[model samples]
Target chain A: MSHAVHSPARPSVSTQTPALEVHGLGKTFHIGGLFSSQAVRALHRVDLTIGRGEIVALVGESGSGKSTLARCVARLEKPSEGAILLDGIDVLKRDRFQASRTFRSQLQMVFQDPFGSLNAAHRIEHFLRRSLTIHGKGGTGQGSEAQTRRRLEELMTTVGLQADMLDSYPHELSGGQRQRVAIARALAVEPQVILADEPTSMLDVSVRIGVLNLMRKLRDEQGISMLYITHDLASARYLADRTAVMFAGEIVEEGESLDLLANPAHPYTQLLVSAVPDPARAGSYDPVHRARLRQAVMASTACAFEDDPHQRCSSEEPVRHQVGDPRNGHWVRCHLYRPGAGAGGHALATEPLPEPQPAA
Target chain B: MTVSQTSFGSHEPVLDVKNLTVKYIGDTRSTTAVDNVSFSIGAGEVFGLAGESGCGKSTIANSIMRLLKDPANVAAGSISFGGKDVLAMSQDELRRFRWQDVAMVFQSAMNSLNPVLTIGEQVADIFTTHAGYSRKESLRRAAQLLELVRIDPARLKSYPHQLSGGMRQRAVIAMAVALKPSLLILDEPTTALDVVVQQEIMAQIKDLQRELGFSVLFITHDMSLMVELSHRMAVMYGGRIVETAKAHDIYTTPRHPYTQALMGAFPPLTGPRVPLTGLPEGVKFHNIPDLAEVAPGHFVAPFDADAEAGVLEGAAQ
Candidate 1:
């Protein structure tokens, strides 16, 4: 079950200063109306931090609390527990005025449904104009009307949209263009962090790479932090520096993007990574591989994986244990990774996964 | 796999679509959705139509099924199923042909399945209506169909809402295959499901195709799935078939710039980092040159673009 994490010595950049920190976040939804007592745990005590100008991808299957976590951070839904601290300030603990004004100004959310989210009756200019006017933050660029116009043009240019597109309605633009407009709107506020939830899932496959490049540019050039949430792992590996795998309502594994994808420790993560239909890795996704994945447990009350040894998965809780060698700070939340209690700490983390055989 | 065997020397294909052009007839302007597309699905062959949205991949599939309504019609095309002219079929003949001859599994499983009806009832309904079987016999067949998709036969009595997303998709597949259709048209069939479930569904589709020997017209924007599943694939762009070749050839050694871009658009999960940057927005592939045989079995469209444009400008090279 051990898959060796492979990557050359990464350029060690100082990740001392944190941009955003989330501690023990959780959200639960009540099933019925106010009358019923049944509740579903959508998110559990999730903890992670985004470094300055870093892109951390939150990957999972549907109903895996990925969207729920992004929503909680975006403040679309109130977190039932935990704190969302931006620059050491607990945004959730702030007052209503602070939450809307001070909290919202620093963080922006780029939605998946770009066309549906924007008003069909308004032009593209209206969307950006309203955002810059409302949350531009004094002296940050949009000081006067003329400055606002220039800033809007700059935002449009940054996102690879034309100046004439500002006059066009949302419906007039193609699906890809509307998405670029949505991304431009997120950048207009000069936010320090962007919570993009499946922004390119609805766009064309040809244009999806363009948007991902734009996102990478945003992180590298603008020095903006991001929590890119999606079900697609391939895209994440392309755009993100680090990745956190979520299952049900918990973060099962997290590490450097290439390391995590090349060597997924958690069973669910392994299944997802292997499930990607790579022509090069065709042997790994054959019928026998599919059968192994389909028979995996769904919505288990115990630990998420079926490969939990020591039986502590069903009896007790699983905590995140740091992986050794090649994966400096990589963590996996499985009983197998537990030290001394199991087969020892990262004892089997040596063998490199079977390389793809040349296509027959 | 058997489809390639038939394509090697056979003259009569399972599904033959020639010069299929679909257009939206507006009052002022008419825009082509699918134009001059030609392809054939050999017996037991999983032929794929690979393209991005609005490239008219779905339009071609719908034209084959005769499911296009007003505003969207087959402007010029010839569809033949095993030597029978589908375009010349009468309204009654079309009704009898659909589902019995070719079954369509739509993009959304929830929208495809009848929410009000139970799984067993829906599967039985298809059998009774098409095959004219008795209720008891139809249901007995329904249970067997449901089991084919690996769904619990006991859950056949459960509603569509009762099943999970993956289960609902399996139920829809079970229902589509109830009459043992010769061809299956799947448009992004497993796009909504997660990767793990998608693998399961794909495995089932392949298993069923091998057992039943049905030709599949698999339409999706996912190039990786095309590479892994299809025996032969046609790359579509700007409503035209840009390239056609063996699936492996198309993935590994694409000739057309559009085909290369489409393949490069999908990032490999585990490989050397190869960033994909597509063609410029101003590049028009509408007036591409005639399809030329680049290799023995591979066909590619010639281009008249300069060095600064098309596949030359991006990471596809």
Candidate 2:
């Protein structure tokens, strides 16, 4: 909705491998008493990819499993079943120490809470130096010392923090400053892919925009790929090149951010877009007239739209229906958009059940 | 209903606060959380407070409720609601004043709901303690309150875990309005809910306010949500009210650079998209800018008048 995160055409993308790829991701959490095991399906065959220098936002609500997906990609929580390839390396398959270090360093994450993720005991210098040392970019040799110091200053300046802040502890800095330190730490490794889970969600409005702009500037200047996850669609639209609307652990829609926002095909996406409190429409919002929430059905055999129960929706899960041009196409998952699917089901799906005709 | 409710002339304000200041006393250093903040809410008005974390919006809300935690004290201020002095009230009067006169609905306040108690029991408990109602009568009133919030009255038998997040929030709102308190202070009420659910809850609050004639003090970091839901708003920065104006003007023609930045912070749902920029590099809250009024009922705190004049003029058009 704001600045363009996508730059002009680079070297042909088809020739280069994707920066990060996740295939058939499934995460199951076993809860309840030990005697009575219960499987809570957080992710269901979810697949996501990030090309070189691309930012893909995973948008969803509290229980929509977006956080779980991010955690899985970060390898903080091992996936129940899936394969993750970071910079063409099998992230899930490799062992923790030596073999995986190279690939693991290719990815880093910025968490939601700047306070919780950062250690209060450490100064800005500690975090910056620690990240560099872990990635083998630190040391005190004639060549390495000067290079490391230059890198530290560059990282701080890139995030818009003053070099004087390097000596200050996390508690002394403001929320935005602390977050800048976090971003600096993420960039210390010069990671190809940065997984930001609600990075600005905890920040104030003015500070949030500053952080968003910094993120965009980083991607534009350094060409770092990012996975931006958030619950706010507007912020996501502002920052992401491509937007994926996730509901109940499945992508309901994915497309160019602006196009998807302008013409949301999925009922859930439409509801989300419409729910955005329009300042222009102040004092006249009609929440009652909007699309209501529908129960989720992640079962592939059945359509995800539980309210609009059609024969096809019940019998088979609706796959992505291509809309618009292929290069910048809009894709939605709903039975109503399927070819030859008549207007025979619930009106909620944009296909109203046939109204009875009066005698002419 | 837009007219202030005071005496026969109907010119006095409903909830009038003046120079409300709060400070958190640490062992070594005492930090001022809220300083010289002043505003008022009309009989049927919605006054909004917009600011970031530690900016003292919540501290002001808590101080108004006399719910300040230990180590935090309301240093100076006068909070009078419908002619009753809030600061001077006795402990018993404060207890009665809390729910019966002014009630608060907080961010994720639904979590405060007792897990062991039924939704109906929680509402009934409020009645029994606050209004001294019988068990049966309170349950009856509780059901009506649930219905008021568009929730099924039958769900009153369910526990906190049984209800959805939105439902639990609505239930908390229902409890806040159970006595039809004259004023309801909602501090980031729907920040935790989904955007759609948030819209629904705000709509419910608006409808209830319209029907019950209770003033609302709404606070959030969201400029768009604040503009739509509030009649008038105050923008707080570094524990001070940096700007104040009509909700419409706050969006369409904000005078303050901070307010302008706040409006730009949220990407417009509709309208020509502009790159979110113009907040100068390395600007934080500590720098106190002078708040000035260039027009009637509009206050501003520009970063620097000469430098930001271009933005102010642009926003005006």
Candidate 3:
């Protein structure tokens, strides 16, 4: 990795109320025929929190439920069961108009694709002014039009864009520039919490860090709490304070960014970390070797259940138990962590079975 | 540059570009899309072109394929490929050479597949256009091409939407290589997929190239992935080649300041902890430095000759 996104050392998490809190979140979609319904559980009692000014990352593969979680928090999709508290306000309980207006100011999102998210016909200034006008922060009195234009210029500058760019339509800008415009539009409202889902994936490599650095700056200067959702672990390690490794709608592990990356506790997390294409490794992609690796990874699956363990753990059905140093805030849910658990072992509370040998 | 392939006694590159510039004539004034850029790709080697958005990476790719149309116009320079200049080729010749000699896989081109058509039909379309093969023969060759990409022949009948994203990408790549084209141009081939899928696609591309002895002009923003795949990589900035070197030197010790800043900007999955730093303010490629050859094979563009020479001495070891 030639260029990387980094920040100055941040202070450790304090004992203050979280900026955003989610508890026992669950979302289900009905599939198949109406009468013969099949419940596809998108989220399964997931729990997480974002400390003030901390960038918490939710890392998961596609179809692993990261987007679902983001949508739930954004209240774009209502959760079937769970509570999301943003600045002590129950986001779900608020009336439609009140929530829409408040959400515009307090919570905002930058989407995955800049091309799809931004309108092709509108100039950059149109997007900048809409958020301000719609959210009732369109500036007051004394040639407010000039004031709005000035603010638009400032927003563009913060995102490393020139003032002349305001006249350009979305299609006229590059992927990175368009993304910067999207971010500037989000910031026009001065949102307290930002949810960025794969913001840099669609952009060219050279300009990706420019966007990431902007988010870090927002976190440091404005104290905006961000929920960065992505499939890339390197980005998660770089931009997050706390990393939550999600698989099959459950957080297999959560801890300090460096700690989790340096020493991953879960099998899935370890595979992900190892799978990174390290340039240092010569002949890394030998055809037979990669095929073997793929086969091995696919062979591994979630351990099946024998009996229920507890209300939340058993009622909801856990692949394993959460065991680790709760004091250090490092949590791991896998057979490796359970007491008396070994390779391929079940959770500690469950009936014992013969342990399998460590995987080669 | 090492110029390992240059020993064949050809003073000219297999592909030579000189003072190449492109502009897009929009509704307003013509925008200089690609400045006076110059670079070349040799035979049987992967030449990576790395840059960010608006850095004119894609413009270079499109120009090489003769795919740029409408608003885009090549203002200057020449592109010589396979002993014939590409810019000078007639529409009919360009079309003939497109798949038979120089094929291109666009950024997310796999996603552009016709959803209604089966994977077999897509591969057959290429064969039909280039070789005028019969349907039965094309189907047989399609199954073989699918096998080459590690996908089962049974999937040839599946629609584009039915196959997984990875499979769809493989099908597109398979089509590009159906005729064993001399050069394959991949523009951000795996940007949309997950890491695992990205690796899978890259590995397939690499294996196929090695087996077929076809050259690749790989373009991406991911330096790590580029390093892993390419034999040599060129860093482009403001429509110019800032640095070019063997993949090893480019990764371990980059010569250019822009390359250095870029290395510092990306996040690594497994490596020593380097505190992530933000892009510096008011930094411009032309304003800050000049590019110079620091090592035997690596060249870095710095603002001035003195600074370039100074950095070169430090990098000599």
Give TM per candidate.
0.86, 0.83, 0.79
* CA deviation > 4 Å runs, candidate 1: A1-17, A32-35, A96-98, A136-143, A286-315, A326-328, A336-360, B1-11, B304-317
**Candidate 3: Cα lDDT at A142:** 84
lDDT for predicted candidate 3 compared with the true structure: 0.74
Candidate 1 chain B has its poorest 10 consecutive residues by lDDT at B1-10
What's the TM-score of candidate 2 when only chain A is evaluated?
0.82
User: Candidate 1: which docking quality band?
Assistant: acceptable
Segments of candidate 2 deviating more than 4 angstroms:
A1-15, A35-37, A95-99, A139-147, A292-315, A336-360, B1-12, B19-37, B68-77, B114-121, B150-165, B238-242, B271-273, B278-304, B307-317
DockQ ranking from best to worst? 1, 2, 3
Interface RMSD of 3: 7.1
Candidate 1: the clashing residue pairs are: none
RMSD of each: 7.7, 6.8, 7.9
Predictions' DockQ, in order: 0.49, 0.46, 0.30
When summed lDDT is taken over every stretch of 10 residues in candidate 3 chain B, the lowest stretch is B1-10
Model 1, B79-188: lDDT tens per residue?
98877899899999888788878889998865678889888888889878888999999999998887787776888899988777877888888777777778899999
CA lDDT of each prediction against the hidden true structure: 0.76, 0.77, 0.74
Which pairs in model 2 have colliding backbones? none
Q: What TM-score is obtained for chain B in each of the predicted models?
A: 0.92, 0.90, 0.88
Model 1, A91-120: lDDT tens digits are 887753335766777788999888698899
